[model samples]
Target chain A: MTAATQPQRTGRVRRVGERQEALAGYAFIAVPMALFLVLNIGTTLYAFFISVWDWNVRTGPRSFLGLGNFERLLNDDIFLIAVKNSLYYTVIWVPLTMAIGLFLAVIVNQKIRGRTFFRAAFYFPAIASSAAITILWIFLVQPGGLFDEIRGALGLNPLFAAMGYGPTHNWMGDPATAMNSIIILNAWTTSGTFMLFYLAALQSISNDVYEAAAIDGAGAWQTFWRVTFPLLRPGHFFVATVGVIGALQLFDQVRIGGGPNGDPNNALMSVVLYLYNAAFIQVNLDYAAAVGVVLFLVIFAAPLVQRRIFGSGPAW
Target chain B: MSTDPPAAAQRPPRAAVDQLAGRIPSLAETEDVGPVGDRSRAWRKRIAYALMIGYALLMFVPFAWTVITSFKTRADALRLEVIPDPFTLQGWEYTFARLDPSIVTLFINSALIATAVTVTNLVLGSLGGYAFARLRFPGREVLFVVVLATLMIPDQLRLVPVYVLFNNFGLTRDVGQYIGVILVLAISATSIFLLRQYFLSIPKDLEEAARIDGAGFFTTFYRVMLPLATPALAAVTILQFQGTWNGFFWPVILLRDRDHYTIPIGLLFFRESGGFSTNWPPLMAVVVIATIPILILYIFFQRYFVEGVAASGVKG
Candidate 1:
């Protein structure tokens, strides 16, 4: 697909250094090319090979299994649960991140006061380690912790009750709320980076459009819907696509937040975490490789499907 | 047509006023009808600003908690009080001095790995990026596409096979694990793409002029291209450094020994070893240590962080 966009080779002045230039070029690219091949491309292909074999690390055993790993993955209940949880994460995480991100971007993009401070504040979490954030979130949601305290102060239990959910409790401890808590934390932490993306896109948008829309008697809401939203489509698309890709690979937060075993009835089980367990915890190297291949396929296909749905646009 | 001296003098000031007014968004474009419209618009702006501040505070809670809890006594940490009743140096002292001398080791390990990864990516990524961006070589497009394709294959997909690969080589056994992790991240697609964007944006004349002056490809790249690409270099360096510092999954898999563990992995080990009843103060203190360096770097280099992030998105 990208090949069509490859620029044509510009005319080069053929000189004594021409042959040497090609040689040096090859030499320059040699290290990264080899590293990419052996570590990235080669290992990716090796994952496929390992998946077809019954490999056990502890006993150092390997036997041909063909598509047996793939077949087994289909019936693997934990793997299936992981798939479901990952989907749930992506579904909730992507839209929440994009909406909040775009909203913050619009706010900061405006000619308002202290935008620099707001932008930095919103973005700080995005730069922090996920593990650290998960720890902080856990502390916040612990019994009588900051989150709980704030929730009580705000009378959020009634709001939850109004939505037919039970009154406030330990968010990470309860299975029903565990994944939801994770979704909230992940969305909150990640939205900052996407906000930066949207901010760039928002700033790139010319002011004339808004002025024109205003002159045409469009209200603020109408101007946003007709002009700003459409113009910010590329930012929305980028943020969403990246968000889904990232959300599906959810492991760090789950591993740290819900505990490694995906505690509370596996509410936070993610495919990557599942694969990690299979390989490291269970010593089933081949099975993990199979899961890896499946993950590769999912990650590969997600962007293509997203592009089809969102319509790819040139991002700022 | 009405260019009277007073009118002309007024004309310039009038144009400037019109520009200023045009720039300031009106309370409403329609006939104001009454002062109520202006008041309501002012109210809306105030509400928007208030919401922005509210969200910023929400985002800051975790950070504030991390900071305050780090100085608190264990009991104080468990309490909902925003301030520590008896703030002490015990947590910081324990984290740095007594907890595990290897906490210091973990910091060193993270620093070493981060530096190695950043330096390697800068040199090799730039070389490959320069080759693709400027050099004429056979199969450049195809090779470039292959490198770009690696970005789509999620790191999880590489996890098991790479674990197996490192295990077979005995890299998972000790300090070799550092090599294992570094090799995995050495040629990041994002870094290469970022550098390629930077290289492409630079004028070709400099390199051409250098070549005409008898400088070969490598020399021209080093002397002319590399110097001009400092901004991209800094951007990618910060990105790679922060990424490696924040890395959790690979470190968990590759480094089994606590001595070899990076900050994230060590923190996980710290958490696991302490279990649920672990005192919060030292834990928070350890997390602060892990976080502070990256936070400082980010605060200083916020501009490049945004640029690198936005540029990476643009590539995608």
Candidate 2:
């Protein structure tokens, strides 16, 4: 009888302990969950709600639009330009940065000296503030600055001149070059980060695979293209997805480089920059919310598109 | 295990095997076409080194130029000299003295805000991550999914609504702006996700042992788990600090007063105030100032930074 009672008491105690554990779990997540609901989920839902209404701080919900703002955005010239520029930046910058990163990673992965120094040098720009980097970029690309000096020294001014861009072409001030300049700056700042990712991926591939390729008489180029490239599939997918998402959110550089309105005919204008201008500078909160919703859709669709392109695999 | 053949007896004799292998021409030795292959390999190495060095220099030139320009006078900065001719501290002096609210104030604000945000993320992220990782409770999977979903939504999507929300709460002013920024950045999905991933990778035995000893849930987490998660905590701290230190968008929007402006916003204001005939030297000086702290952090905590990026598999 005493043994039976002991078992029952222990079971009851275990149940009480389980209840306490559950309570603790709820308590642990309480603050973050609350903040996430209020800040992230709440704000996201609010954004969607306001997108359908003509809302502003001063007067609040002036009228209901019911997708009217999105329709207006579709027809808006600046919005289209912003979208085009964002796409252009993504298309060019993502591949360029990834290639540079992969190349650097491969180089650094080789058993060589000073690889750490080289890695650090390449990554330094990435750690710097974007605003600071953009400011420096503005100075670097100024007419007759270091770039022009290098162009003159390399005897490439004539090539530029033949292409209708003079040696002294204002990189940030020219519509043709403004977006490209921003892309170059971003590539410089981000490639090192992607390089690190690619390096990690490369290091995970064992030497046995390389030896197997070598035994098959594959040349260095062939081995890289056949064995290494395919093996970096996961890295490619990750870099591409993250790059696309980040490129679409380009704002700090454009804002600093081209002003609040993307100067030189909105060439540097990005979707996020447009959203900012719409909300704060223009004080059109509802329109900005609409733009935000559209940007969100594009950002959401990007990874799904990538997933399709890369295909689901065990590595993923 | 002891019942198996002795370790040495279980394997072929090493010297005999080596001798047998040496009798046959190894793939590497057989493939070596004497001088031709050696010369070609040497050439490849040389080419690889050249390409890497060239790219590294390209990656570093802008920064090198920024540093050089910072030492030059206004007129000297515009010159095409690689070295600063007639170097001066005028730029640094001007940055400290002439900037509204002063550079020191900007640094303090950035440090304070970043510290607060990092600390909150460490505390809340660990708690949430611990619960999601080790604690069993209803809605665990759903809540984890919700946290990840938040990561997909771009900050721009929530910008307008969050701004309006803050404005309504009277948080878009002075110290309130700091509080607002902290609140928004307090506990990121990335932080929770990273910590959760780390916590999940830890063995269950430790927590189980603590539980069997009659330690409460909070005590086990605080005593046994938190101390064991130092590496993950370090990663989160560095990532959060760097992110907040360099953050531009929210600060630019929320912090209107110069006194409350973070470094990025201050840099933007400095650039914009220069207008058409911008003072490049002084501006570069401020850029250097803004970049130095992050550079120092990266140099010292380089491992943690790379680990953070690898762990998150996302851009900071």
Candidate 3:
């Protein structure tokens, strides 16, 4: 038996069960990859195809319209508003969320008393479904709502009260404030997730570094900037990348917060909401796909630029 | 106005430190940095904590308001009182009874769909993870890279085509809705890839020895790999469970009939109830109920959560 299995150096006279072993490996990936291809990959392709055609469920598919859908999208005013609002949200929310997240991570990562409680409390919002919280946030941001009540108590809502849309806190109804309301809500719900990422990165930093810094006479500020920030460069990059992706894909909160029409004058109409409107609300699947394709390019291009600039990992 | 200017205008350096410096031990809050320096650091820390705490309070305020309003009459609710006075359960009862039958069924639909999705994801994801980790076949790295590439697709970009395909598949309604949701969720590449990395990090000597003992690939997988990979599995379990539980867009798209709607989708029908009514109370109640399982798991398995998330990047 030994001589029968002796090396011919071809590596082909392997175990009797080589096929089964390979089959096992293949089996593992097959189911998930198939589902992924069906739901994720297929949808991506289909969306791209739909974008170029005049496909509507009622009227059926037709010849491709090249970039006509995108032309329409560019001129749609509402689409322009959506694109602008998303950018505004991204620019405002990313830095605010990062600052808060880092602050919380630094606090809780110090392993203070009631640290677990603080962590749980901070993470509670993240655990609740986005839809549920968006609904609750709409309630809070409404006139005479929780924020307005607190604002009135603090006497900071002078102008809003003077205007009088109820308590003149009709945050979503007023086109001027709808986008800001959504951004604030985004920061609140998602900061916890960012906090967790920072916490994870913070914990991975060696404690010996802190001890060494203490001996060198470096103060807290010095420790954070010199030792901590440099060490956390990788984590910072990751959060930035993930944050951009998430912000670009914003949908649930805006849709639920602003309602089906995306608030007055489409002030809060994000790209995803616009796409949903085209496909489901207006039944223009092709044009919706066109919007999706634009978003995909925008999202995918940012990461490519990020990769070029960051050049992979911390320079250190 | 009398701020110190470096060494020129410095007071005797707040000799509080010198008084006890030699005799006393390390004080974390030493005014040792400089006068304004110490206060600024303290101020920054305080501001950080205040921002975090204020944000957290703002997030919870809506839920708190809902709870308070849930126990009040519509007249009291309209008045927007600080405290819920003359409390009653009528709002809660109205939410449960006055709501359509579809709203009540939403809880069960959401629960069943989430549970199914979670179960399928676990089984499929863990198996793929195990194979990817242990079984190094031809082109394994290429396959994994392809799988990881899928993560780059923004979820919003995939909505249109997926909805269309599901409509074509006869899985868009009734009992099939849960199946459709489960299928969509089952393709998660993260958990599968994560578990695989965790599995690979384990020493393969035991598995090798099992193979030498003539145990088949399936046997080795079940006996050695699965047991040691329990923590990874648990982490993925909670992660996928929470993700599926909170799935809003899918449940909305796939379940057209209100009766088949999940909790988030079901709660949405309450918006049609009136401008504001007792219906909001029950929706809030349902939100609380829906969040309980996820909160419990997250609190209990926070460590694993940290591990899973960290390992994800390490593998990437």
TM-score per candidate, in order? 0.90, 0.92, 0.86
Native-to-model Cα distance after best TM-score fit, residue A116 in candidate 2, in Å: 2.3
Q: What are the per-residue Cα lDDT tens digits for candidate 3 across A39-138?
A: 7778788888888888866445778798899899878988888898888888888888888888777776653346566776776677788877777777
Q: How accurate is candidate 2 locally (lDDT)?
A: 0.85
Please tell me which predicted candidate would have the highest lDDT against the true structure.
2
Best TM-score goes to which candidate? 2
Q: What TM-score does candidate 1 get on C-alpha atoms? A: 0.90
Better of 2 and 3 by lDDT: 2
* Model 2: pairs clashing at backbone N, Cα or C within 3 Å: none
Report the C-alpha displacement of residue A272, candidate 1, in angstroms: 0.8
Clashing pairs in 3: A51-A290
Q: List ranges where model 3 is wrong by over 4 Å.
A: A1-5, A8-15, A58-60, A158-167, A206-216, A307-316, B1-61, B78-83, B273-279, B305-316
The per-model DockQ list reads 0.41, 0.41, 0.29
Could you tell which candidate, 1 or 3, scores higher by lDDT? Answer: 1
Model 2 chain B worst lDDT run, 10 consecutive residues: B1-10
For model 1 chain B, where is the 10-residue window of minimal lDDT?
B1-10
**Which scores greater on TM-score, model 1 or model 2?**
2
**What local lDDT score does residue A237 receive in model 2, on the 0 to 100 scale?**
88
Q: What would the per-residue lDDT of candidate 2 be over residues A61-126, giving only the tens digit for each residue?
A: 988899999999999999999999999999999999999899877776654668678888777778
**Model 1, span A93-161: residue lDDT tens:** 899889988877767665567867898899888888877777878877876777767767788878867
lDDT of 2 by residue, B1-316 (tens): 1221222243345444334323222223335667888877677667867877887788778878888888899878878777777979898888888878698999999999999999999999999999999898889999988988898889999999899999988899767999999999999998998888778767788889998898989999999988877877888999999999999988988897989999889888877774513888878887888888888889899977876777677432
What are the lDDT figures for the candidates, one per model?
Answer: 0.81, 0.85, 0.72
